[model samples]
Target: MKKLLCIVLCLALASSLLFACASPAATETTDAAATEATASEAAATEEPAATADEPVTITILRPGDEEKVKSFLEPAVQQFEAENPNITVEIMYESWAGWIQTYPTYFEADTQPDVIFWWDNKLYDSSAHDHLVNLSNYLSEDFFSQIPQGIWDLVDTGDMDGVYYVPNSVDTFVMYYNKDVFTAAGLDPNTPPTTWDELLTDVQTIYDVTGTPGIGIPAITGSEVLEEFVGLFLNQATDASVLDSSSMPLFNTADGLSALTMVQNLSKYAQTSPTEYGRGELRALLRDGQVGIIFDGPWAVPTFKAAYGDDLDNSPIGIATVPLAANGKKIDWAGTNGWIATRESTAAASAKLIEFLMSPEILLSHHIIYGSAPLYASEFDNAAFQYDYWKVFYDEAQNYKLYGMIGRNSATPAAYYTALEEVWQQLVLGQISAEDAQAAAAAAAEGVTARNN
Candidate 1:
């Protein structure tokens, strides 16, 4: 009986060992199956495409003014960044000294900024049309619904068939007079010049009475200087197409001579060696109260206000619509400074950045701080825009069919503007006759047209 019991115990021990080994294999198989199923479920579920840890960087080019950026642009960018934590904005501020030459180079190279601050009239035709993306197809309908029709109409001009640029602000050259200078000259500062004759006579009066230069004209070799002529005269002329259908000079006519003569007459009372000053330097002369009148854009309001403090609206300075044309007309050049993007850029990200910049809240804030006229019609009702000077600008923007140096619905060769500036410098310096300047400009334009063809 004892032997039988031992055999049974040994058999039970063997069975227990076998059960233990089999249990481990079964458990391992079940665990492996559960892990695989869990991983497959996770793979099928929708997850956030991007996380805060992995962010995209969007680069942009903007002319830098630290104070101005701090006052407005920087804050707007901060707001954008806060809203879009997954995206970053890298801003590079190129100086005007080399910007004109360097800006075009950016597109030629493989590394270009995702977005660029382009002058709607200046670079829109040349840089934007060729290199940038046509945004009309990508922009949402709600975006178009927010902007004014007239503002959008200006974008689709000449060979630019689609909306390739978005204008942040609209501006025109207006007459900013130093009221103190006017008062010192015993002239009524309240009554700004209405006619070209009045403008010249007032300038001469300021010179004769104040012993300071009556006006400071930007006569340098640039499109800004040419726009002075176009703003002051060409818009008033009967047919102001500076470039005809074929991009040839059309300004050498009788109206052209007359415009040159008007500028030449005013030059006599202008700061000596006016060509020595660029627009910003010339504006500085006005800011220091050395010049009585300055033909500048609304973009300069911040500087003017910064210089004169509380007296910006009266006593020291006043803003007026640009002097009227000889035929009792009021027309001038205007620009909608644009935010343009490149075709090679990450379109989704770049478009979002543009939409952020042009958003009504940010744009209106910029206008309020920088004094640029807003493109959005909703901005017209802001309390900040109720000032008389702003009213003058708004009236001109609404009434006059303003164009940039390269007229509305038209484009000009870069050489044409270059020639106009050279001719204007000579004309202002007493080195060339109005007729001669006109002739030289037309001839240079003809050469440019031929070369382009």
Candidate 2:
């Protein structure tokens, strides 16, 4: 009986040991399963990190000749795409005239391009002004530092708090002369006019000697060219803006009267039917040697180059700074065009593309292709800018108090131009005295101010 009881005890002890060992193995397996399940659940709930190769697409447009813009932009777009891989860029081409008419519609529909080539003076008056993403938030200080402070001030309308435009093109006016016309007039080609009196004398001499209009005045009745042409004289005479920041008529002052009188005196030698011609017509006349002088911007370079080739700066064309007023302040009428990113969703990529476009190498090429004055100080060193013609433009950009369009901040920015055109035409045609013209212009400006401000 004792041997049987001992055997039972031994069996119970073995069973207990087996049970303890099996329990531990089962717990270990359960723990391993729980860890695996927890990891799977975690992966299911959490998102994977985004890779650099994520797809994105953005569209861009510049209002200009489609062929010319595409010629330079298509290759740049290809390079940009290759470098980015994840981003696709599409260029929406529109002509200047057509875009001017259609842009308001695009802005109203929220269908404007992701990135746009825009006018600085007109931005405050456009629908896109409110839609533009503040570029200051995306562009770095280093990028802003590359441009001059004067340029930034030129584009500021005082209507906005942040930088919305990235000015790539800065343009100022200079007087372009035909050397042949100067020689025919018995005036030295190398010695162009230096003052308002000299300019008038030279125009008269050229008209008397050559029997051709000495200067082409672009006073097309509904166009802005006349306003710009007269505004330069006003800026030079008054040493002030044509319209104050409040869009009031600054051109109705005594200095403004003197400027108008100067324009009237000079008009004696200008082309017949001045109201029929625009700046483009005048430039064409200058290029053909039919007009002795025209005040134009750097955009005239390419046209003259195509016509004259290597002799552009030599015997045929003579470029000089716009003649000084009696006050001798070096002031000029200037304008700017730049890039603006409109869509908030694509602002990041749009800024990236703008940065790429504004890079020194790319910007230089753009300036060359667009025939614009160099915006960067570093660009002056480029071989393309080494010419004497470019030097005149560069110096003017450096020295002048560059003023923008009149009524730039007005609700109807074109009103200033329209208001002055008829009265200016009358002044040039001798239908009204300069004093009367001044009053008419003032009344028109007051009407615009009342309606717009």
Candidate 3:
């Protein structure tokens, strides 16, 4: 009986030990499952897709008709949005009218633009001098390399002989002529006039046959229309950098006088007085075949296409280089507008956009659509663009010079150009000779220097 009781006790102890071990193992699995469930829930809830509830707006300022801009630019913006889901671009159209008034006020205030298109010369230099952001760090080296050479040079302030802005396009004069107008008038459409004398002769021939002036120039009130036309003449005769490098007025020279006189003497054959050739009127005249030739930018190409097509339905138009001087020299004035951040506001995001905009693909698009010369060698896609017009500009871009107030100081240039504007108007109107105009310009420039220094 004692041996039997001892055996039962020993069996019970072994069973008890086995049960304890199983209990611990079961609890561990439950804990692991609970922890894994919590982790899975967290992983599922971590990232949320973007919703319309959040939208960011960035602004850009550019030129040309708002309607025209929207038709072309909206698509490009949409393309950008596909890649940058977080960003939205809002475009604002700026005009030459009261531009100075509008731009400075917006820039100086705390509410600033994320990016904008700006004239890189005197305007940018002034912005830089005021301690606005410098975009040098943000713009990439590849982007810098993509800019056409002359276009990039225009943005350099020549302060430290360094660049402050990133140029995007080359804006300059090009010739627009009515194909139907010339054809109907028995003029050869195959040849475009290259020299000043030939241009006048063609106009004379057109008028003799059609009773309409062959060429039109705006001698009237606007600064841009008058100044650029005059600049072309100055450029053809001599180096335009004389004024910029020397900071002196050279308008009295034979070159300047000849440039001014070329248009002044053309008054008899012009369709309208200088003041009469405002943009609105010019567009109408060019389309109607009342005026045969005018100097314009790439911006006009699409407009001509829409209105005229390849036929004279609206009177077909053709593009050519701006007419050269009587000396047979071509001097086309080009303006390169670029993106600039004030020194204080230069940011990484801004540079990233600049980098994107400066890519070869973007530049090629810019060239084909905007008529800017290609900045990259690969962008030539010569087969696609299929126009010799690009070469005319590409060749000229290498030699052309940019003008404007671009020094360490902006106030002097602002004031000086304002004064020179008056002198320019007087010269264009034939109220003063080149000599007198130069003296007035000199006096005004000297006054600004003296006061500022």
Candidate closest to the true structure, highest lDDT = 2
Please provide, for model 3 over 387-449, each residue's C-alpha lDDT reduced to its tens digit, 9 standing for 90 to 100: 555555556666555443323244445555455556666765678876676567668756666
Q: In candidate 3, which residue ranges exceed 4 Å CA deviation?
A: 1-100, 123-128, 183-186, 310-315, 326-330, 343-346, 363-391, 398-409, 412-418, 424-453
- Model 2 lDDT per residue over 75-108, tens place: 8899899999888999999999998899889999
Off by over 4 Å in 1: 1-57, 66-78, 81-93, 96-99, 122-128, 221-223, 368-371, 377-386, 407-414
**Alpha-carbon error at 82 in model 2, in Å?**
2.5
Each prediction's RMSD to truth = 12.9, 10.7, 14.5
From the highest lDDT down, the ranking of the candidates is 2, 1, 3
Clashing residue pairs, backbone N/CA/C < 3 A, model 1: none
- For model 1, how does the per-residue alpha-carbon lDDT over 179-243 read when each residue is reduced to its tens digit? 87898999998898988889999999999998989988887665456445543576576446566
Weakest lDDT window of 10 consecutive positions for candidate 2: 46-55
lDDT of 1: 0.73
Give the TM-score (vs. native) of candidate 1: 0.77
Better of 1 and 3 by lDDT: 1
TM-score of each: 0.77, 0.85, 0.71
CA-lDDT, candidates in order: 0.73, 0.85, 0.62
